[model samples]
Target: MSGDFYSERPLFGGAISSTFPLRFQDVSDIRQVPDHQEVFVDPARDESLIFELLDLKHDVGDNGSATWFLQDLATEQDAEGCTAISKGRQGREAQNLLTVYLANLRLKAVGTDVLIVAHEPILINPLSESATAVGAGLAVPAAQSGCMAMGEVFKLAVSSFKVNDWSLFGA
Candidate 1:
C-alpha cells in the first residue's frame, strides 16, 4: 500500500470521476463494455472497479438499497457463499442519495471481496430514459497478496466519486 500511487481518474468523458490506484487500467474500450459502464482493471492482481448507470428501481426503498443491490449482484454473478460484511450510508446530505455495501463471495473457485456503492440521483436522466442510479463495484481477489491495499483503494474510490456533469445522466 505504501508503494501504491492513487489519483483521480475521469470516467464517461470526464462527466464522472473517482480516485483509485493508477495500476488499474481503463479496459472498457478493449472489453467492449456497455455504454452505461466504465470498467478499470489491474490484470496482475485480478482486481477490477466498475461504474455503471442503471434504471432506478422504484420498488426498492433507499434504506436497504445497497444490500439489495449486493444480493442482486451475487445472484447475477452466480457467486457462492456470499456473506454481507457491512452496509452504510455516506454523508449527511448524501444520506438520501448514497448507500454502500461490502461483501465476500466465492466466484469461479476464487474467493473475492466486493464493494458496492449505489447512488440514487435526485433527478432522472431523460436521455437515459430513467437511468437514475449510479453504481460502482469493486472486486478484488481475496487470496491474493495486497488484498488490504485493494480494500483501501475501493474505499477511496467510492468516497471520492463525483459527478462533474449532470448531463451525463441527462440532467
Candidate 2:
C-alpha cells in the first residue's frame, strides 16, 4: 500500500452528520445512492460541523447536532450507504440512514483520532486548543482533498470525536 493515500477527491468531504450507527448482525441493510439532500445541506461545502458527544463515549450525544458535509463522486462504482434498519428499540428515528457515503473515493483514518464526550458543546471557545486542534486537523484533510470527498470528511469528523463502545442513548 502507498504511504501517502491517493485520492481524486478529498477524503474529508461527503461526510454527513448521522443520528448514530445502528447495530446489526449483517451489512445488508446498507446501500449506496446519489441523493444526499436528505442527509446533507449545500452538498458542496467541505467544512467540519462541530458535534458534542452525549453522556456516552463515542458518536454525537443524545441531544447533539453535527454538520453533514459531503460530496457525491461521479466516477468509481464502489459505494456504501448507512443502515436501512435499526436493531435496538433505542433507534426509532434515523432508520435506514446512510452512514458511509463512498463513491470512487477512499478515506483512511490516521493516528490523529481523538474522542471528547461531554454533556455540552466544548467547541464554543474558538481560542481553545481543542477547537483549534480539531479545526486545524479537519481543515488539513478538507484542504488535502480539495473538498472532494465531503461525505467522507464528515465521517472522519465523527470518527475523530466518537469514543469506543460509546452509545448515544446510553444503552
| Candidate that would win on lDDT | 1
lDDT of 1 by residue, 21-116 (tens): 787788875668877677776655434577766666556665675677777875554434342211122212222211223432112122212233
Give the worst 10-residue stretch by lDDT in candidate 2.
20-29
Predicted structure 1: lDDT: 0.53
For all predicted structures, in order, the TM-scores are: 0.62, 0.19
Model 1: per-residue Cα lDDT at residue 11: 85
lDDT value, residue 60 of candidate 2: 30
lDDT of each: 0.53, 0.26
Q: How many residue pairs clash (N, CA or C atoms closer than 3 angstroms) in each of the candidate models, in the order given?
A: 0, 23
